[model samples]
Target: MPNAPAADQRRLLDVQALDTRLDQLAHRRRTLPELARIAELESQLADLHTALVTSQTAVADLRRELAKAEADVQQVRDRAARNQARLDAGQGSAKDLQALQHELESLAKRQGDLEEVELEVMERLEAHEAALAEVTAAHTQLVDGKVQVESERDAAFAQIDAEVAGVQSERATAAAGLDAGLTALYDRLRGQLGGQGAAALRGRRCEGCRLELNPLDLDAIKAKPEDAVVRCEECGRILVLLPEDH
Candidate 1:
């Protein structure tokens, strides 16, 4: 087994590296741009569906109105025909005939009004149908777009998962080579220090906290044994010295 302090430092470094990689993977998983686009597309699709439904309902209402108007015109024409036959038969008094003519004229006017209403309703129905076609086209486009976006998002997640799996395997291998006490200390320190237990010391600066060490601190670190573990005063992270050439 490695000495307690050296082993702890090594294990802490390994854990820090693994944790950094894990954080990167988690961030990639959560911040995919495609996911935001997918949500937007879904919302747009929902709105389009609502509009299409409303347009279809309007079209149905117009069709009903057209049918009713046609029926009314037919009923009026039938009444006019009956009135004309009664006037021609001369079986009614003059007053009765005059009333029948007035009624027939009223029926003609009502038939014309009903025909005009039917035409208007038909025109409105045609417009609604056109609008529905446009909505259906837009909906189809959105559906296809959503499918493509989802596929892209899934592919990105799959790639990230594979990377995470590889990183985990490497972490396991690294952990296996470390002493148990070192691993325990590393885990404890990492838990206490926001997932970071080790950092590199460059020149007289602590990379963990980006703070320069005082002259006394630098001298003390330099005086320590080559294999001794040192910690950063500012950040409480284990400091690893770089080689002279680095």
Candidate 2:
């Protein structure tokens, strides 16, 4: 492809500037404050959910235990009632009566032990449920906060997108002056070189690489016509020569 005119070649610098602005806008969008806040909140929400699940499980287990303990007490109480009915009828021998009395006492003791277990389980379940409620409420708060943060993040992205659109329009205007082949080369090189394809030759140094050009290469570059676009030896970016460049 033919080289672009000397004046049009400098237009490439304007295009490069616009591209850099676009890159900065993208960076700003990614680093928005809401992005970090959302990330931190998401992590906290996960932990809270885990805690809620654990508390719920404990409460369920304790409920089952309480139910079983209450059932055991009821069974023992029923047996003691039947024994009392037999004693009230007074139809048993003295030996039988004494044995029945001993059995009733044993049943009473077992019932007391079971009732104690039932009360302990009830207290534990109540505490576990209360803890679960607290965690759930906390989780709800975080969820709401995340929603707000996401909304703010979207607004930030929209702002950056608008700026990007404006910069892209400017880039198009700058690119229009260059030959198709020149812009194509620049785009390809920009992709390969971290969003940069050109830099001005400032004094005796290649600004793209911040390197002082060797004497032989520098002399050869100086000998080229003003319209001749050159590539930097150190970094291979299109080297733009300003009028004051030596």
Candidate 3:
């Protein structure tokens, strides 16, 4: 059978109080609303950045295509100009002049077709550039929003950390008065029992689980000597007895 001296048993209630406060602080830290808001903002910012990158890539590709199209049109136009000068100079043989004139006409038709392609590409490039600009602006705004959210979350973390520090100090003082063996037992049982290792026996109930003891269990607990470490038969929690209340 396990037993705690009178002083150790009294400290159990203090330990339980400190442990419960610490648990509440931890739970509050995890459930802060700022944490959820920060997550939502970060998710939105990621999507905006991805959209901006896609838009910028599309604009860049179309600009390159436009550049190549313009160069092709200019190259063909220069060839036609040289052929026109040769025909105008009247220096070629008659057969050669006729061939030069025919070549000029073919170059003119090709230049017209290429100019049409250049116009289409220019329009497409303009649209893409506009889309890129809009996305870039939106992405910039989202980044700023993310920064604000981070600041809020950091501030919340600091506040919670301060509260936790205070509670930890309180718990240290409470734990110092307990017997080493009893405290170790409580720590071990807490790990297995979801953070609660002991409860007071008040009005025939184990306060940890709020279950009322039946006649047999109550009788057994009543038979134990004061200062004897007694566990609840119903829930296996170390049950503390208050002489005045019992």
Best by TM-score: 3
Decoy 3 TM-score against native: 0.85
**What stretches of model 3 exceed 4 Å from their correct place?**
41-50, 87-91, 94-98, 219-223
Give lDDT tens digits, candidate 3, residues 1-246. 578775677678778887888888788888888788778877887888788888988988988999999999999989988888888999689999999989988998999999999999999999989888888888888778778877887888798789888878988887776777777778887888888898888978889889998878788777878768887777777888877634
| Candidate achieving the largest lDDT | 2
TM per model?
0.79, 0.79, 0.85
RMSD list, candidates in order: 3.7, 3.4, 2.6
C-alpha lDDT of residue 160 in model 2: 90
lDDT of 3: 0.83
TM-score of 2: 0.79
Q: For model 1, give the 10-residue run with minimal summed lDDT.
A: 1-10
How high is the CA lDDT of each candidate model? 0.82, 0.86, 0.83
Score residue 111 of candidate 2 by CA lDDT.
Answer: 85
* Of candidates 2 and 1, the better by lDDT: 2
Candidate number that wins on TM-score, 2 or 3: 3
Model 1, span 1-246: residue lDDT tens: 223545445556666788889888999899999999999999999999999889889888888888988888898889899999998898688999999989988988988988898888889889998998999899999999999999999999999999999999988877776656556656776788877777877888887889999989988887777566677889887787665602
User: How close to the true structure is residue 163 of candidate 2, measured as C-alpha lDDT?
Assistant: 88
Model 1 CA lDDT for position 50: 96
